[model samples]
Target chain A: MVAINKEIVTLDPHLIGVDWGSTCLRVFLIGSYGEVLATRTSAQGSSSMNGSAWAYEQSLEQLAGDWLQEYPDIKVLACGMVGSKHGWLEVPYVACPSDVNAIAARVMSVKGVDQRRFDIVPGMAYRPANGVPDVMRGEETQIAGVLSLRPEASQRSCIILPGTHSKWVQIEQGKVTAFATHMTGELFAILRQHSVLGRLMPSQQNELDPIAFLRGVEDARQGMYLGFAHQLFAVRTLGLMEMMPPSSLADYLSGLLIGHEIQAGLGWRLAAGLEQAPLILVGDPSLCAHYAQALSHCGVLNASILSNTAPVGLWAIERATAGVHATKLAHKVNV
Target chain B: MVAINKEIVTLDPHLIGVDWGSTCLRVFLIGSYGEVLATRTSAQGSSSMNGSAWAYEQSLEQLAGDWLQEYPDIKVLACGMVGSKHGWLEVPYVACPSDVNAIAARVMSVKGVDQRRFDIVPGMAYRPANGVPDVMRGEETQIAGVLSLRPEASQRSCIILPGTHSKWVQIEQGKVTAFATHMTGELFAILRQHSVLGRLMPSQQNELDPIAFLRGVEDARQGMYLGFAHQLFAVRTLGLMEMMPPSSLADYLSGLLIGHEIQAGLGWRLAAGLEQAPLILVGDPSLCAHYAQALSHCGVLNASILSNTAPVGLWAIERATAGVHATKLAHKVNV
Candidate 1:
């Protein structure tokens, strides 16, 4: 075991938290007071590192080598795809309705070079009312982080993590009761890049046109004779007729996809008599904003954006596990 | 004008009918009685010939070189994508409700090498109840062909042309009244090739498994809480669970897409109080079979499959135009 430098432990990072996903690697160095001292992000995601023999440890050292050298005693905590089957370790998912404690208890640890300790938070698996199985890797940690940060969120809330595979999760009493996944972003990407609709869109553009997007949202909300498939064709026809400009076609397509996702996901919950609760939006801010706008269009007025919940989630799990270890040691001393 | 050989026109051939689509060129040499005396096909579709200066004439001569050499007096009639804006020549769309004669009256002619006559049939366009404009090129001719072949179809019928852009047309009194286009096949292709869903599917399969496809159809018909977006993720989840074999995933995906399309397309017609008339399916036989199965699953049992409608439709249009020309000549003589 490496010697722990007690004097520097207080001033240096007490914990190194990571939110590693399929396409990105983000690390946060946190002080004893749970404040982030330094952070680093890289594009070395699980997909890029899958072929390496020791991808997890190699990628971690590559990103945080200098920080680790400066603070060797700091403990590392990671959540997300790092624990998936294709990631660092294949950590089995904790079946739902899982709380922070349950997830904390199931945390798996690995030893890197010089006996450095790495604790990985396991993902959550859910079997919804539909009987189809669903799994989420990184979002569970975000939910835990959100619960820890916002005390009122422990009562009840619907959390949405909008990204490639958008996750709609429900939390009651600080436990994840149920959640579902939608391939909204992925579908939109493929359709826009590889399908016929791509022909009408401008090759490159940064900002989205609000009017075109809202029009798409309005069309989806109407829920008339045209479904998503039929409505998609209208994007091309309207573009051909010069009713909608080619540059705005991408934004309009974005609105249609997000609109349909919201209608199917939240609309079902609304139909089931679920009361209106402020939705916790997590993930990239730009993507979350789109979801928030779509939710508002659907009359969902209460949505709060939560940015960078991954570090908080990892910190919470680390604290819970450390507390459990401390309680076990105290019990032994008493005996 | 090229000299017309009387004996060859009466005995050998009178019309050269062509079905030119985005990906294929099919030509039929028809005799005086509208019987197909010879046939030829090539991969010279509109998309393949888009860059050529005189693609329409060049592709025709390439496919029917020998036929044209033997029957120099033959009048050529072409339909399908050959008349789109990006095609050989842009023929204006005849707005529905339009009869066979109305479509024939708008036929545009082009002069090729050596004064060869090429008459192009115009496609049909419609504005449905939703006020969105829908158009079809090749299928319009097939609908006219179906009406000619099945005389009883003149009263009223639903014609389905299943392909990349599947057209669902409604005909009343031998005229196309309304129609809608669904991007079902395109969606399926893109999802299977470029999306994450493709990862769960097997790369190669010779035939579709009926059992797997029917299960997807059943799932779609159930209309459970899970919408199309949600249900799409199930394909991946179910595959990971080993509940669905990778080899059969393609067929299942096909059924889900086609099933949802049928539910939206024909299901709307059913909801509109239109009585069940046998849906006249015009397209490739194998593709029609899959649609036939899906329609049967939806309880629309009366579906008649019309194979090679492109040639028949071209023949019918040629006959109509010839009769009109003869009437105008006789009227001039009477005056």
Candidate 2:
């Protein structure tokens, strides 16, 4: 077995990568080459854990205690909301345009129950030239994983992490130059669950009706001049008028929000002069599919999808940090 | 006093105007001159009453049974969601571009427990040339009231009724020609109460922080290219970075939504070539103030505010219907 360092004794089952988000915790026991050897997921997200140190420790122990027991010195790399102000430990954000090395260097360390250190990757913050600052906690890791999987994407790409807060990130030469956060998913959830539009729709999510969804997307694309809030009213009107059934209304609403998001995202890319950059979607397969459909509808036909890249990203960061430390140690030994 | 009908009615306690909506029931005792004599409001909105005919009858009786008893033949005119599909009696929507005459002609009658007939005014539906159909429940009556109060508005005007579903109506020659619904208020409410952005703001809405609000408006004004959902994330980032406090985030969010709404409404107005039409704000005074401020900021200088015009609107509809009925009777007699 290849030695990682004095601390991480083996390369196989090389690292423990944790993607701790607001509502879910995903753990990956990764091999040296960034392959996920085994995986575990739980609903014990950071938010549910209430940022309690003991709870976080207990959760980690419960989820991957055997890995810690079997490989006593293997390093752990965690990302996402687990690094936020209300996370296990408030790992500060690394500002953009940041590379894997910049992110790796800024990771904060916390001790597990056995006193072994775990590295929590810092999130990235992007300040627009004149608007309010934008921030992403877990998406940076996903983007990193995309870069690791498709190295060319690192040179020039626009990676979209489509979820609650969808991020359209700009990458240049292996660094995230800038990114914007779109609240499309969150808006859809709230609108479908709480607004007047929700009343006309079935309480539960219906199956995605492709025709209805595309209708919504087309409406959004053509009705951009109508304003978003106005366009949203169609959700209710369509249901009331029986133009769209209750089952399809939700899909329509989803399409409308996603459509608007793609329109805006494309505009953002065009404005950044990254129009020629390769476009990539990184998220849940189904969500990516919806985004892919929307992007294709928006005349973007070349966008590709990558699923859950957190493990590889975590691996990349861990290795980068280890190399930086190894170089520092060698320099000291020579001196 | 003047005899009004064969059933024997005086003109002083002219009509009972009810503004029964989704969340609240507002009743106005109006005089012959369309002036409100007395008003009563209750939390028994149509939704809460659950389309229970008994509950709606009881609500109206409890609030204005005295007036009904005093003038046994007095006419009653009700508007808003009270006539919705889920209301006391489902009145079909009067298609646009409809005036008071068309709306009054379609008024449906319902019998009270005492058997006195009451009129429920139909809402309006506007199907755009190439988009989903738009519907408004009670706002049609309010438009009628605006026309009565300011006759010149009938020639050409834009009346903005700002609320849960803010309606930007176009009036041409005393008729609601076309209108657009912007869900600004509802959107703000849901986003402030449910979205991730809501978590950064104070649970209890803080006092309007004007500076923070204006800042958000300006950002939305200049950052239209960034897409609405993307710009929404600033509500969270601005709070996280300590650039803006939690208390101000809600206001900032409000400003952003309102600003976007105004931008869209203005664009709709411009597209319809009604730029020269007088702009009027008709809704809650406080909400109108906000809209007025937003409108002024967007370079529309003279938008005026008209508060709760439902009473006059009901009066106008009742008079129009009475005139129509009288005409029908006289025509029958002549024949």
Candidate 3:
């Protein structure tokens, strides 16, 4: 293995990357080149595991212990929903672009807290143009870790992170200046499950026709004259089906919402010949792929799909405080 | 009662009434000397009860079942939501200024429906200036009923019927020349129930503050450039609680949406003092109170709030039909 960078104390390769969440805790034992070596997993979801320190802690300890049995002395990296209030050690929210070290500052050494010492990561916060305050617990780390990997994306880029809550974050040189979170996910859920529109759509989410999806993008770009619900009903009442296929409705809903988020985030004249601003998307491969396709319709062709930084964040945390002191030793020599 | 000329049926005294669907559907049971008579009642509602007959049919059945028990031979009429797909038998919609008899003729008789020999009134429909087709179902009958009660309202008047689906109807002379239904109710439901805004609001619908409600109006008036959802999240995110109590979020939501509707419906020109057109409101006293309050914000003072007209519609239908019968008889004589 290549010599370990003294500036960052990490094994030539690391032990495991831990992501403890409300539902599931995933562990990725990765190598130096970010290749996942062996995966040892355990079932210890936060929400399900009542705030008991013993059983839940033991579940994680067993996971790491099993990994150590294989390598005997590999380092571990962890981040994600595992650092929240209900997470393993209750790591707090960190301000954005503060670097991997500041995030690790919140990472406390829990003696007997677990089988070994592990650091927890913090999230990020944003204030939007409308002056509305918003925060993301795990996604911030991913964005930062992603930024850390590719410095080029740090300039004049908007990150469309789609999830249950789609967040459009404005980043300028490694700093998350502002962001807006659109309730696209919840809207989809309610529309598909609760609202009358649900009747017209499939019982399950599936492929949306491109034509219908584009119509939704046009509506979002138009920006005025209809409420989300009003616009939603119009799709049914105005006989959008007369022009477009019925199955396209779901795709249209997803496109309409995400396009609106993009439109709002990229606050310029949305009408007329479109602007060619590049969009950096951080989401599931399938969704971001669709979103990138949708963006291309509006002349946003240079859209880059960024890999998820959850594992990168876990790696960053592990490298910050890994076996045999990387950063500390590097700093001593530099001084 | 004095035996008046059959031609004088148009000048008959009528009842003041209310319908179930949060809007109008009223009739007046008045004596020959304009004295109040027995007022018949029925539950006013508009949800599409698919397994059952049209909503209005059920409404008519309920009223007829109750009233026939008392005045078996008394003439009855009604209007508003009951005139919709959910209302009394499906009345084929007529284009507006499109009057009383046309509505009656279009009314479908529900087979083995509500045990009554009454005609349910239909509203008006029209093609908009934008070339998109639009229509109203139940409110037009009441507007006609209102004009029948106070013919003076017919002289270039604007009737504001506020509810879930608020309609601002224009009456030139005795005709409802045009009208548009704002999906205010649908917007309200989505805003209050499904949006990110729901979190900012209190679980109890009643706990609203008025000052914030007024700001909701101003926000709409000044053009906060907000998509209706922002008005909600603003309350919690901006700490609008500092400026106005959170209770007003409901009213603000109501006024902001309605005001936005007015902004859009009145065709961008509504802001340059919409008071140039006199507004006559036809709705329940409670909702009318809100309409009056909102209209004052738009600076249209002393707007008239007429009594709901489902009952008057019931009576007006009888009067109009009676006149038609008289005309048939007189034409027969003339021929």
Label model 3 with its docking quality class: incorrect
Tens digits of per-residue lDDT for model 3, A5-86? 2323344445566766555677666555444444544566766667666655577777666554656566555666555555
Model 2: CA > 4 A from native: A1-11, A324-335, B1-11, B324-335
Candidate 1 - CAPRI tier? medium
For residues A1-335, what per-residue lDDT tens digits would candidate 1 score against the true structure?
11132323345567898988889998888665455656778998987876453777888889988888887787888988888777777789999999888999999988876687888899998876756688889898888777767768777778888888888887777788888888888988988898878888889985789989988877766753455677788778778667889999888888887888888777656654454765888878888888899889888888888776777677777888776321111111100
Task: Give all candidate RMSDs, comma-separated.
Answer: 6.8, 6.5, 8.3
Docking class of 2: medium
Q: Model 1: clashing residue pairs? A: none
Best prediction by TM-score: 2
Using Cα atoms, each model's DockQ against the true complex is 0.51, 0.77, 0.19
What's the best-to-worst order under DockQ?
2, 1, 3
Q: How big is the positional error of residue B197 in model 3, measured in Å on the Cα after superposition?
A: 4.4
Winner on DockQ (1 vs 2): 2
Candidate 1 segments exceeding 4 Å error:
A1-11, A113-115, A324-335, B1-11, B324-335
- What digit string (tens of lDDT, one per residue) describes model 1 on residues B14-68? 6888988888888887655455656677898888886453877877887888778
10 residues in a row with least lDDT, candidate 1 chain A = A326-335
- TM-score of model 2 vs. true structure: 0.93
lDDT of 3 at A87: 58
